[model samples]
Target chain A: MRPPLIQLQGLTRTYGRGDAAVSALRGIDLTLFSGDFLAVMGASGSGKSTLMNILGCLDTPSGGHYGFESIAVETLNQTQRALLRRHRLGFVFQGFNLLARTSARENVELPLLYRGLPAARRRQAALAALDLVGLSDRAGHTPAELSGGQQQRVAIARAIVTDPAVLLADEPTGNLDTARSHAIMELLTRLNRERGLTIIMVTHEEEMAAYAGRTLHLRDGLIDRDSAEPDATSCC
Target chain B: MLLNALLLALREIRRNLLRSLLTVLGIVIGVAAVITLVTLGNGATLMVKQQISALGSNLVVMRPGQRLGPGHDEAGAPAFRREDADAIAAEIRGVASVAPVVSSTVTLVAGAANWSSSVTGTTNAYFAAGNWTLAQGRLFSDDEEQAGKAVCVIGQTVRAKLFAGEAPLGNTLRVRAFGCEVIGVLAAKGQGAMGMDQDDTVLMPLATAQRRLTNSRAVGTVMISLKDGVSASTAIADITALMRERRRLTTAQENNFSLMDTRQIAETLSGTIGTMTTLLGAVAAVSLLVGGIGIMNIMLVSVTERTREIGIRLAIGATGREVLTQFLTEAVALSACGGLAGIGLALLACLGLAAALNMPFLFNPGINGLAFGVSAGIGVIFGYMPARRAAALDPIEALRRE
Candidate 1:
């Protein structure tokens, strides 16, 4: 049996101090194995976003024990965490935070550049990433010229270009319309099913959550439910 | 990595061409002003020294006593006489040549055209002592000097003015009412030490000047030339002591004479010009400092603009040091472009002025290297803070920014 890719125990993420101290995540225990497409759902400020950040290594939990593929996360220094993030995780954001005034291909190449790849190799990897996103034809088109859906796809390509162990997305389809959101979710589902990649996503919409293999519901930082959606198979 | 940063920097500056040009204008004007003024000052000092050296020796002139006006003052010392001139020449130990001179302006009537010129009285030794060379014919004879004969020689400009494009040697030109024969035409002297027209003069026997022109036995002043390998200080002291003994100068009064040294004048003028050049170079350097400030200001704006970009880069595996190096490289590239433009402008200005002013073009390697080196240094110094800020940005916060 393979080790769990993500293990969170006694995760209590707090904010502020004194009487104003608020726990974003309170005493949550969770395990996510490889190839698991889990959706985290909550209302606005219900700690879904905070949970996503901690899972993606974007933010450190105030109090928690997080083990990723048997590596202790809470004990790691900043540089070590950053290195772990670079080598093991990927992130897609709601805003599609691609570099402006730069082309789709170049934006994808940015991650590889930080990887310290050679110039020619950087360009080749960027091209392959664009191809995977099916935006190879629009490789040279800047973010300003690309559509909202196309831009998000480019962002997705950048996130996965480093070939991280798991992909974590936050409100990845929040900016899209119904059809585009379905298309993006369908792309996410295909990557999980075919690549067998572990994925965790945060969203408030039940419709988007149904696409994942499992759903974890949160209310006031505590896990309220952890179950497979009845309609999850149909969406997949 | 440097190339990428530099390319971005170049693109940014290119996008803001008008502002970049305006910024460089300050440097251009400042550098041009410095180079022109400094070169002119150097040239002026050299010109003065050349004119002074052409005078041949440490020469001193006595124009009667200390003059209240421009002309001779005969109050303190009696008017210079040929007898006193002979007495000084024979008695002064360090004096090589003690020739008396009297000058007057008169119109010389040649064939048809008439030219107004000055006739100076001096002996044959005047040419050797004054460093005058003959262009044609011969110099005045010793018999002409002693017998007070009416003979004269003409300078180049006087030759041209009187002869009017004709060979003037052995020709008679009317000096006032007396006709004097031009024995020789002196070499072209261009302008004099005081920027006056030295060539526009005639040299005549000093005796002839007193006997024919003024009909007086007195001269306007005495010209004394010291011998080679002689020190003016010691000679001046000996002459002062002897002249005092001869004229009975009482201990109560000041030496009623002014001593003029060409070397002292040259040194004073050179020192003043050097000071001016230093000041001009300093002013130019101040503009470069302002240019550095402009670089800093723009870099701050760039860091703010690229904050989100910095965050994204950090998230993508870029270290803080990488981000810092990127911004620093951009700043350096910007300044390197400006520095190159400035140097080109300075060279153009230097060449233009060289041709316009007829000065020899001199390209100083030291200043050029200094300008480029200082420009790069300005980039590094001014570019640090913004680079550090970019490096220190929190990737999470920056990426989350709307």
Candidate 2:
């Protein structure tokens, strides 16, 4: 069998210290292979966001072994972590955090700019990414001028522009209505199938989870259920 | 990366054009005040030096009484006679020439044009002692001066006022009761150091003035010119000693006369004006620091306002350094624009003031360049704190800010 693309064994995350210390993740053991689309779901404060942040390298686990490919993530310094994020990870936020007053194409080019790509190639790559998201004609439109769904499309385009190894999305469609949410989910589904892009998403909605190949439910800092483990029962 | 950061900064500034301009207004006024004050001060100092030098090279004027300037009241002091001028010319080693002057205000009539002006009486040595040059015609001949002939040389102002457009050479100019022939005209000397009109006077023979005008043998003042390379202090000491001996002043008595050195007066005036210029410049420089504080205030506000934008950049793989550079570049761009505008404004102000004050407009590149460099430096100094604050923001917290 091919080795797992990501491995987290006995991972734990705690905020603050001493009597005020609170555990966000409690001994999470998980494995993800390349091309797998996973969805994480839980109620508010159920540790789903914490797990996502650790996986995305935006936060360090207090105790754990987080192995991405062959690199030990928790051992990396802040600058090294940033470099890993810059070269391998992409993020999509719930609010569609595109730079205000900036053109859609320029928004898509942001990651490439951090990559230090030349201007002409950055333009070409940004346009291609915009085309993939069906925003070729709206490339010049700023975030304020674009619709909510279009802005989310631009956000997705920006995330995938650098060809990152994993796209970690935090409630990618939390602000959208049912129709637009499904439309965005469809776009994510197409990117997963056509480009074979690995995606790990956090959401509280079952409908959004349906688009993923597998689902993991969290309850009070521990995994209550994993869809891959079909025999497991919900703890709550 | 620097170019990209600069482009982003410019875009941000362009989006908030009016606010950026208002933010830099303090810098604009500060730099303008500094350059204008220094430039005008330099012009005034130059004018004073030029006017004093125009009085004569190595020239000294000895007047009765120890006080100088207005309300001197020299009536109690004894006046020097014509013999005193001869005595100084013969006794002093550095003395090149001496002229005894007996001046009186008189009304002159030339072709129905009557004007009141001071008349100076002396020998041909007066021309050498006071640095006078004839614009037209000739100086008084020895025979004309010795015989007390009615001949005079009018100054440019007197020529312009009394003669108008007509030439006054050989024309009879009536002095009170008698008439003197206009033998020559003195070149225009413009204004004196004390703002008096230097060209509004007439020069006549000592015998002529004594006989026709003052009706006295006493000379009111003695003008002395020293030879080249003579130390003025030494000459002044020698002349003072000789005059004291001739006036019969004892060792216990204070000499009833004062000496005025034109060169020393020039140095004192220039020194005072230079100090004043430095003081004004220092005050203006403080305003520059205040302008820098203004920049810091606006930059802090800008960082707080753009916290969300900073968060977006960080989340998308931007390093803290990049964010810091972006905000710092914005601040420097704002101040540099203010600096350029200030330099332009100062040039216009200096030109207008120079013309209005009748002073030379000396363009000093060193000060302009220094001002611009200092303004740009203020940007770096005032920009660092805000940039660091922006860089230190947490991605999670910043993204949550509205």
Report lDDT (Cα) of residue B285, candidate 1: 81
User: What value does the lDDT take at residue B9 in candidate 2?
Assistant: 81
In order of the candidates, what TM-score does chain B achieve?
0.76, 0.84
lDDT for position B114 in model 1: 87
Candidate 1 residues B21-120, lDDT tens each?
6655544554455555555556656766778678765775655676433464567565667776677678776778876788888788887878888889
Q: Top DockQ: which candidate number? A: 2
Fraction of true contacts kept, per model?
Answer: 0.32, 0.38
Distance from true position, residue B16, model 1, in Å?
Answer: 4.4
The two-chain DockQ for each candidate, comma-separated, is 0.37, 0.54
Leading candidate by lDDT: 2
- Candidate 1 TM-score over all chains jointly: 0.77
TM-score of each: 0.77, 0.86
lDDT tens string, model 2, B151-266? Answer: 99999999999999898898999999999999999988888887889899999999999988888888999999999889889988998899898888999999799887888778
Q: What is the DockQ score, from 0 to 1, of model 1?
A: 0.37
